[model samples]
Target: MNLANTLAAFPLAVRKFNPRLLVHSPVMFTVFIGSLVCTLVSIQQLVQGSPVAVFSALVTVWLWLTVLFGNLSEAIAEGRGKAQADSLRAARTSVMARRRLAGPGGPGTFTEELVPGTELAVGDIVVCEAGDLIPSDGDVIEGLASVDESAITGESAPVIRESGGDRSSVTGGTMVLSDKIAVRITAASGKTFLDRMIALVEGSTRQRTPNEIALNVLLASLTIVFVVCVMALAPMANFANALPTPVVLVALLVCLIPTTIGALVPAIGIAGMDRLIQRNVLATSGRAVETAGDITTLLLDKTGTITYGNRRAVEFGPADGVAPFRLIAAARLSSLADETPEGRSIVDLALEQGDGQPAQAPEELSADVEVIEFSAVTRMSGLNLPPGYPANPGTRVLEVRKGAAAAVERYALERGGFVPQELEEKVLEISATGGTPLLVATFDGTRAQVLGVIHLADVVKPGMKERVAQLRAMGIRTVMITGDNKITAGAIAGEAGVDDFVAEATPEDKLAVIKREQEAGRLVAMTGDGTNDAPALAAADVGVAMNSGTSAAKEAANMVDLDSDPTKLIDVVGIGKQLLITRGSLTTFSVANDVAKYFAIVPALFAATFPGLGLLNIMGLHSPESAILSAVIFNAIIIVLLVPLALRGVKYRAVSAAKALSRNLLIYGLGGVIAPFIGIKLLDLVVALIPTIA
Candidate 1:
């Protein structure tokens, strides 16, 4: 945290000591009660000039400091979150929207009224043109545009948002860079994506995860056991003719309980979210963050997650009798009006082949040319050329189609055209190698002929194999889910180095995989960016949605990756595991240090009454008062010293769980039992110099 945030959190730390609030953490609250009792007893002793008044007062002061230090750790963590929230809030500035009038007027039918963005409500249609700020979170209902979403995703590269697909969702506060789109706002004012992100980082809505709740219960139970043991000591000490002071009993109790972990638990959890924000991810709940730590199987979509989503034309395979030039010209002419990545790739590949003079641009084509966009039902797209066109000077209009081999073949057959036997073999050959075959055909109203096949190669993203290897090293199995056939899916999965593959999987299939893994008692994580993925996203133990995904997908998922990077789950899992490891390590140290405190205080409490107890004073402290005071001071100071570790979290190593456990036990456990002995004994040497205590 910066100086400004730390300073702001200080008062908040003090205010959190309110009894009503402190009561929620049973262990810390017990320390609070002990501090209160010691405060009252010290005041009474000082008034009556009791011999041990100074010692009682010193113990009382340290006990209070112990509790305050714990509060400071949590406040500082929260302070960091508030700082992030303020910056996010700045992006939610007001802008004017061109509200569209709801009528049959279609695309350009706007009301001519510039309404403030905050005035827009859900289902209101707003038109966003080049250089205009998108009014609110919504889906593109008309047209398409290149939008600058750096304000939300922190990515300077613009992304495409178009109608009728998974890439349609647009966030408010993002700027439209090119073209115009009519957006039907999906969220009301103050309920935008930006608003939700601000709330998440502010941590006002953070709830404890299940594991954290269980750990808290365990700590409370240990506190109660220690309380009973300390209370029983009072009667035992009295019988020995050496009754310990109430302040002494209070100090012993505070040091003996698991105060260290109790104080840092909230800080550790908050720091986990802060780390996720640094990675440009927003988690809706702390439970999701913790669940990420336990994920054993990760289900990933093949297109974007494993391989680059864009399928590009790599080669051309012609029909047996057609000339290569004839096939290239037909493919180029059909794709000129198509705007998809694959279509654009076909045009680029055709031009690179250099068959003839540069082809005419889509705009230069005659106005009679009709552009037929691809649809799920048709599974094909092409241009319907008018008769006497430059490429088709025949008396009848020409239908130039390029799409799925089956769709184009069916179109050719209906017009009395037969699929070339050789071309069918070429389609199967491409599919076997994980390439999509787009059959190109031409029909002049009377005769139809299959022209060629465009081989669309799916490129596996770079470094995918290494990422899959890293997940495997962490004992997580990576499974690739794809709609591609088994042969194609296997090729991509092998190239990506994932452990498993699911072919021809639907949205329901994705959900079933999550349930099956969960039934086997393994936590699962998955990523998605479409409405079809909403069910699987919600079903997975840890669901991460891309910021560019539809509102339904984003709402169902627990985490949102603002940069829309599907591979970010790897880093997220590491951050989550670090959070759990930090808590576990600190808890080991906390419980271990109690071993030293017990030896230091127990021997001093009865050494004079029972001479044999001196044998247990291994540190051989100057006196009973100095030994007790030294341990109390060490216990209180350790909390302040550990605040940084709690906030920064422990560095996680991707080793097996057993190796990690063994390593942590060797370090924190052994170190915990040893460090306090040295620290308390050193403190004893200084405490012995005090004339009153000596």
Candidate 2:
């Protein structure tokens, strides 16, 4: 632990000593009562000049430390988040917005006004330029620009925010680096995502997760059982002629209860959220983080999540008797002026074939050349070169095109050209291999002929197979949803190692898949970015939306990945399981610690009256007073020792739940039983040296 953090949290820990706040935790509150009772007994003994006064006062001080140490652990976890919230608050200061005035010519047509960002509301249009901070959370309505989101995400690299698509949403406090854009505000004034994140990290909006609540109930019940047992011990002690002092009885009761786990529960929960924040993920509720551990079915979107979303040209298959170079040349020429990802890939592949030589830039094309953009209706994109343009010196115009197999073949057939018989076979082979077949063709005035096929594929992301296997090992079934043919989806799924897949799925189908999985009693998690994904994102148990996704998707999801990584759900799941494991392990250690305490204090309390009980005192301490004081001191000191572990959380491994349980039990449970024996005996040796206890 940093010395600065400990010093800062001490005051906050002191503030948490109020009974109104302490009463919420039943076990800790019982300890608080025991501390007060011991304090009074110590005062009574001191006034009467009893030699036991010093021993009683030391026990009283340690009991109070036990409660304070618990508060300090929780305060340390909260302080980390409070510091982050303060930084976010600074960035959230009101800025000047270039609000576009609605004039007679309509919105964004004429003038602008400088208004406070806080004054802006939903549907208000604002213009942002280079070096200007984005005024508020909104969707870019017009233009495009490079935005620096360092203030919000802590990443210095600039990202592009443009009109339309998944990357349209812009956050306030992010600076516009280049170009200009008209943004239509989507969030209300004090209700931005930043405000929500600030509240979450500050611990104000945190609520106890179901697992935490259930564990609390169990701890309370155990505390009650121990309380009855301690009361019964008093009568038994009197009957045996070995009545213990009031302070000794209180010390024994405090040591026997499960104080270790009771004190660290809040710290464990808070630290879980802190881990997520450090990973650049913002979960709306602690419940979502907890639920991630229980997710049995992971419904992942095929595009951008499992695969790299876009299909790129990887190979060129020429028609029989046609040179490979001819096919590559035609593919490159048709895609030179094309701006689409597929088109750029084609040019790149062509260059790779030529030993990485640079090709003619798109801007180098003459004015006579025209670019034919691809559309749903045409299903093809190409270039039309007029005569005497570039390397062509013919009288007739040359038209080069590349697109879907059927679309390009139909174009050749209509233009008095024919598709080669072998080209059809080539297309099927590519399709069977899960690659898109784009036919490249050329026409000069009257005659047209098919050149070859371009093999484009949506490549599966690297390490997906290993990642899926890890999830499988943890008993999670991976399902992929895609809008492709069954053959394509199956090929990709096989390569990615997913357990199942939904082919040719639509938005409704995606939602139905999530609902069906949930109906079968499985927790489903999915990631999406488009407006069409909103319903499904909301329906899934753990919905993680990409930061680059549209506003609708971000609003509907329960968690947001600030870095826009689709696979971050894996880390979230790991963190959630770690939180549960940490809580369970500490609970085991706390209960096992009681085993050693019982041996140290129980025998000393009765061994004087019942000689046979002396065998239980294996530690062989000097006296009953020394044994009781040592157990009390150990109980208080252990809370402070485990504070760092509670705030940092237990390490999580991607394994089955049974395996994790066994591992934790072996380490924390068995170790817990042995640790306190050594600790208590060591403390006894030290306490015996003190004249009052001896």
Off by over 4 Å in 1: 1-5, 94-119, 129-132, 177-179, 357-361, 391-397, 418-422
TM-score of 2: 0.92
Task: Put down candidate 1 lDDT per residue, 43-72, tens digits, no spaces.
Answer: 999999999999999889988888888888
Residue pairs with colliding backbones in model 2 are none
Compare the candidates by lDDT and give the number of the best one. Answer: 1
Q: What's the TM-score of each model vs. the native?
A: 0.93, 0.92
Deviation in angstroms for 102 in model 2?
0.9
lDDT of 2 by residue, 442-554 (tens): 88888987988999988888999999998998788999998777877888898899999999899999999998888999999999888888999999999999888799999
Count residue pairs with overlapping backbones in model 1: 0
Q: Locate the minimum summed-lDDT window of 10 residues in model 1.
A: 388-397
Cα deviation at 636, candidate 2, in Å, is 1.8
